[model samples]
Target: MTFPLIKHVRAFVVRGGGADYHDQGSGHWIDDHIATPMSRYPEYRQSRQSFGINVLGTLVVEIEAADGTVGFAVTTGGEPAAYIVEKHLARFLEGASVTDYEKIWDQMYFSTQFYGRKGLVVNALSGVDLALWDLLGKLRKEPVYQLLGGKVREELQFYATSSRPDLSKKLGFIGGKMPLHHGPAEGEEGLKKNIAELAEMRERVGDDFWLMLDCWMSLDLNYATRLAHEAHKHGLKWIEEALSPDDYWGYRDLKKNAPKGMLVTTGEHEATRWGFRMLLEMDCCDIIQPDVGWCGGITELIKISALADARGVMVIPHGSSVYSYHFVITRHNSPFAEFLMMAPDADKVVPMFNPLLLDEPVPVNGRLKLDDKPGFGVQLNPACKLHRPYTH
Candidate 1:
């Protein structure tokens, strides 16, 4: 019997009705509508501009088998990511075997070696890899996790992620994350302001809840140490993206100073097992945040998680909560997945098959729940209004 081979791959750039996904007020970037009083440097002002105002791009891979089974995968990003999907990835995947996902991934990785590894190349590879996994699951009549190894956990516990105080209260989430703000100013004043905000967030969630703070690469070692100290006092669980990736020594130092029970987490921007291996070897972080969509898709994430597991560390897949939801439920060691209350109108922007739930396995008492649906269990909403098509 002949195995199924992928017939075609297509990419799309869909513009959704919202601000750039990253520009939302976790305090990293200012809303574009607000004009700065000072004549700031061009680079500084541009960084503050909002990119989430519209859907920059979404890449979907449709793989058709000889038997007519169809599988889909999607990855979203800003201009660089979108450009790779549109200009390069699909051509490489054309006529490839969906069954040999690893081989195909290797092919893409080597092909793009000249462009250097990771970043946009791996991100684009991530989309294709996910679509391939989705295709494989459909072909085998099993969920992607089962295909990877098997279920480690039947259900997953999730932390509610939001920047808005009222939304966090309404969601009844037991765990919440605050957006990363720039580290304290030159004086104690900035440090004082940060501590006050953390205290306020702690009060909002009460004593029983879990809380994390994202620094969004906004702090240096000195500032990170100070904030970590205060955050510990507030009972914060972890400090994420506290410093730039280059600050390995800073991370080691920050880790040493962090409160006893508190953990240091980062890696959303780091790529592949190589990036993570360094973080692990250096003892830089207690928890690793790998995006299944970004870190070479399911294939590399499984590898990265195993690396973390061997080191007695934890794996928490970043955004694309819908994808991570299914991925996490199947994994045994993944601690918690992030549920973004602040994500762009998830229900409206996510495909129909991937509808956001308001009930159990999601926002239950204080935790988000998982479903037993087949494959990833999410179907693209056939009713989704924006469906643009691109062919290679």
Candidate 2:
């Protein structure tokens, strides 16, 4: 089981939607009036880009083995992350074994802890960690899923996240999660509108299909509680990321106060196992959604998922396309996956990270059958321009 030493590490930044899926152009459903912490401001409320959600662009990390095999990963961090990867993180992997991901990850995290326990620094570290795993898979000539212990199920089932769940239902997803367009700042009328939208969609999709709301950390405790109760009337399966990720106490209260049948979910913005320990140990939410690209890559996610699995909690990763697909298929706790509707109007299915990844998989009729391709079964899109902002 000899593995080649890592030879070169490179970091690149690319703009306009890849790993930075939020950097979409005008008229994309993702950028259209999605509720957020910045929604209180009248001007920025209309579009997320106005609040700089997509400002980071994308960070791509490539780890090349001495054998000339290159494994790469993409995450949202842009030039800042690229700088971290090239100037800081690359030292851990340049001459390390491709199989020493654990040691490399430990060094990368501890060396940067003075500045980054989470967020941008963790994102850069995560990109490198994922690239290491990709390199390991390539070196072993196995798909990442098999490297993770093989699939527990025959295929992956998914729910759609978009502005229109009705269209997703027609597309055959098991559930549809719509963005909550108006937050507490929008007031009572906005509250009514939010429930009305849910009710309307519930009617269109019938009572059986699972419908949920993604608040995107825009609601207060009182507002989230109220929304939960009202949305429960419409058979809302869950209310997601209703409060700020730091509000563990608030999440605990919201989880308790939410309607008996409705579930409280959060953690898309959370990072690392320690952060998730606060969520789980505090009884914060029913399900913890960690984005593979953001929540410390596969290495940290393995720890995070194990924590959740031990407590009988489900770990449904956020919309991370193949990075999530490879991990999700191997875990029993992750029964299904999330397919973010990348289509501008949510009218059709498209690759989640379009134009950034080649051979990226998408669900057909709400299900995905993963192939045995090495690494994550995809490659950086050759046509997409990658900017090498920094070099180690």
Clash numbers, per candidate:
16, 0
- Each candidate: RMSD to true structure? 4.7, 0.7
Runs off by more than 4 Å, candidate 2: none
lDDT of 1 by residue, 68-129 (tens): 87776666554555566656776666677777777787777788879948766787788778
TM-score of each: 0.83, 0.99
Which candidate tops lDDT? 2
Question: Which pairs clash inside model 2?
Answer: none
For each candidate in the order shown, give its overall lDDT on alpha carbons.
Answer: 0.65, 0.93
lDDT of 2 by residue, 143-221 (tens): 9999899999989999999989999999999999999999988999999999999999999999999999999999999
